[model samples]
Target: MGISVTHKKLKVELVGFRLSTPKHYKIDGVENIDIERYDHEIFSKYLSILLEQENVEIKKKIDNCSITLLDYSENEISSYAFGKLLVFKSGKRQRIVNEDDLTEGEFKNRDQGLKNEIHFVINKTTGVILVERDYEKIFKASLLNSFFYHNKNFIYDYVDEFNKLNYNKETKTSIEIHKNKLIYINPLPSQDLFDELEEFARIKRFKVTKKVEKKKNHGIDGCAKELEDILNKASNTSLGQNVVSIEYYMDERGKGLEMDSLKKMIQNIYQSHYYEDFIITGTNIDNDLKTLTKDNITKRFEFKIPVDIDGNYVDICILFDKLLFLIQEYIEEHFDLDDYYSDKVRNLIVNP
Candidate 1:
């Protein structure tokens, strides 16, 4: 919840904007401001006021946080297109690529396969800031874009590091031998549950051939069950009960998700990727999310959106107090999937 550095530039984009006429309420600051009227002056002034409040809260959170507004001309906002490379702590800086870097293939936010692509939006009713794009796709691609394909474990490496900050238990490497020969080779310093499990499976001769990896999709078990089956083949070895498994972390219907704020301090703990999606819903959902320990907010932005699916309207309330847990959970599920093709399903990666 503590802050160090904050974002300086603010981007206003209307790329995927769809502003339908308000049916029930009128916009403030400008009299009778409706979708039909489309008063740019009144809307701009209202947005400035919101930003001013955010700036005040940001200054209070960080001693010397600085923020500046981007003055985009009318034409610029209309045809908004650019790279959004970013660098997190311990993360490599992403670079902007020329048009030649693009290829034909399907991937999340396949926005020309660019590493960094940022998009922002505002909610009409609540004035909350929102994003429709996959912030996670661009963020991960920024760190480790695939020349041919991606590895789910690549992103999990960073997510595991972040989970360490809260997980009280510490892990150290242990070497187990049978007879005089090396029967097991569970090794290394991290002792990350998944890492150890992956190696443990390998030690039991669970060979995950690269061919199976290229498959488009698998069950929640992914190739993990295949590894499990291989491990079962070697009765000489037994996996620890606590070993991480390739089980679906979220439910098939995504019933146990919530949202809250964790702020920039999360960067210090889990300096890898930031995913912005909202799948948690139900009454007082925001309150359920904030109940986690050591939660805090230290950013100047908001996201609001209404989703209409099958004629049902759903509103997402996000206050990101502790999100690394959710991110870790998603990574666990992704472990069973092809790194290149595991779509986040209803994970609704939202950014606010």
Candidate 2:
């Protein structure tokens, strides 16, 4: 069981909030989401819903309580996961598309306008409000119990609010909560949030296939195979050095000094030098020489080419792919690492 939280008179300062109105585009079977677009109508609609859910009457004076968040990242992921009160400024409108003029600039101009975006500053759930001043510390700090920080903890639109009171004198086990403007309602789900994100990210990840394929088993795998090989080699090396290396060589992995050694291993695989040394790949050495390099790596890791440079043929982009692919393919099928690689305790990672 976890420790029960206790709170005193939880004071609050309503900051501001902003909602994304992305210009969605599906280009070449990929999403191109543009979160910079400031849709006043969408923001107004979401605000209306939030206010209704809160059930608190917005006094005439506090009607303009919406304060644009002065500082935060405009990243698509950050907007959905953690909330923002991004303020956009109307710069020079550059292009016109589908009858709407696309403006090029919306960089934060606090002194330029009244509130364009509204991000709130509240200290109720989280001890420190996600204000413009202390965003750096709050963003990196480990505050799981903090409501504003752990937005995904509860499925709600806004931070869940609650009031806690001291234990009643008559009842030892009962805690009383008699506070005003403290209890809040559940959050209303946003409209098609993930769908918008999928498209946005798809556009961002759209890749152009290069016509680099020459023939099958023609030494290098060509463009397509090179991309695949590159991905595999990069992943395998990262897994081995960053993850597997640590499991086996915890002392080296844990220390900040080991990053250079591990990084070189990853670079070796990336640059088609996986057979350079056992340190770069993994525990197996015999299979590496038989299947990939066809030569044993010496104790000093002497420089030697793994394949016939003249015999190998492929797109200039993937001339080295042959050596890297063979090295990677051989290891994937036989990935048994011994504890000998790491200078740690015996049997630390005999087989990973």
Candidate 3:
């Protein structure tokens, strides 16, 4: 007797109030919708309708929703499950096709459609709502909960005060205020109010140095030496340092020589000293030879130079630690220090 292997088909269960449009709306139906189409307005409208019908009120508006997706072939399994629900509910089969019927490109397109469909159902279940009204309240509540949960010392200290002000007008005004303080929303700040709050929080008293150190040298050699010194100092501290140096050489009278020099310098750096993990710095980075030489030896090297910010023509390399302690410090100083650093360190450790 021959041994037989039987593969089990995956079953995806999606539960929500079914959307009943006034008229039949064809949504490219898993065969024609591309990834772009899934992100388009039509798909979002479809999602909004499904959400509305399901009585799901999301705290945030459903302007866009990101969904996890599986392979195109797997869509058939989900569709089959959906079809089963439709049949059970309405005594009819939902139109679906097997994966083998479509070409490779078509399969991807179909997969996008499947993702959109699944997202539509999920959005409905999650309860789509506007961010201004619902999400703001939810977010404030979540923040207070988090503050209470983590800051046990503060919570204990202010427990009586917190309880007394829990529902009071003044407390409500302060606590429920949106964008009155910095509000971080993933990649960007939530609003201009949040940005203003960030700026306000960043305001601090600065003490002026009585003596400013004047550089004796002001060219490429000076810049390079200065970079080396900074790296040396950083290495002396807990932060470890790595140096990536670029040197640009050009004769005074050549046309298009500066760009060519930069290109050659970059190529040389890439070919010879391309440290997978290191700080980058450059020499002979300005129009004036004397200035370039002096800068190379005397200036404390920065990851980003003033010239770069001003969009001036210059050759430059950045010197930084392999561990990115400086970058980490910058994030901490400028953003939600603890939370941001913890997340970043977690990612670095995991990835490393």
Candidate 4:
């Protein structure tokens, strides 16, 4: 990447120095001595000598360009010695520049003007430099390849795997549909597939009703009052005992309601003069029916088709007592019920 405008200029401090000496000159107190000269070649040679003697590491390089060095601090050197050497080699006539002079905008622009220019920024604490390169073309090429491969194989592989699993025989389960309700008998449907079915029903203008049963252990009066409250709210009017529906979420073992409770509710509904019909609906009917028959409770009602909001079947049990009278009209209008049922069963078996 190209260096940003803000990073074009670099600032460094002269922290140490080394000297080039005649092999036979036995000198004392030579560490603080200042020398003078005035040529680019001489300056470069003297700087190179200091770098070599101090064992400084070349922290950054930019080809026939700038180089920076870092010396071990324990070597005992001073910045004045290095400056003196620079003054001696470059030329006594050259004026000394302050460290702040290195930060001029003109100097930074000059360094950044060339195309494909590289730069480095060093962390003073660690003596490590960050090397920046101009590699826009290379980065763009690799990015294009990544986008193409991800869009092609990555998506297709997932779809293929999903289809294979959907068709596996061991995972298939049949769906049963009755009236407006759909029932899954064997394997349970996954949440994603169920959501799709719900969406389909929503598009078809169907309303879904879910019957939830509140568990009642001993407070029959409280349960009955609560049920009355729910019915009143749903209908926007007070519902008397007789106008209520008693439903249960049944399992294979039995009806979810106790026999005495069911009887008491039914009796209350029949005695109340505020309503006419008292119907009881249950899911998982096989078990419920077995339990009801064992207990000899024989009240019967027509079953309503239970569908999701999208007009898709969710569960098929007994409908409301009113549906039995409308069955003939319903069948007359929907001639493709058999085909629709078949499709639902096939989809459930494959996707569930």
TM-score-superior candidate, 1 or 2 = 1
RMSD of each: 25.8, 29.1, 26.7, 42.1
* Residue range 15-45, candidate 1, lDDT tens digits: 1211221111212222221221111222333
Model 4 spans > 4 angstroms off: 1-248, 251-255, 281-352
lDDT (10s digit) by residue, model 2, range 60-157: 12121222223222233221212344332332333333435554544434323333332332211111122221211121111211222122222133
Candidate 3 lDDT for residue 18: 14
Question: Against the hidden true structure, what lDDT does model 3 obtain?
Answer: 0.22
| TM values, all candidates | 0.17, 0.16, 0.16, 0.14
Q: Total backbone clashes of model 4? A: 14
**Which parts of model 2 have CA positions greater than 4 angstroms off?**
1-81, 84-113, 120-126, 133-172, 181-352
Best by TM-score: 1
Q: Candidates' lDDT values, in order? A: 0.24, 0.25, 0.22, 0.25
lDDT of 1: 0.24
In the range 118-139, model 3's lDDT, one tens digit per residue, is 2111111111111111111122
Give one digit per residue, the lDDT tens place, for model 4 in 182-301: 111111112322222222211101111212123332222333342453343232222243222333333345424343444444344332222212234333322221111101221111
Candidate 1 deviant stretches above 4 angstroms: 1-15, 20-37, 48-72, 75-352
Q: Between prediction 1 and prediction 2, which has the larger lDDT?
A: 2
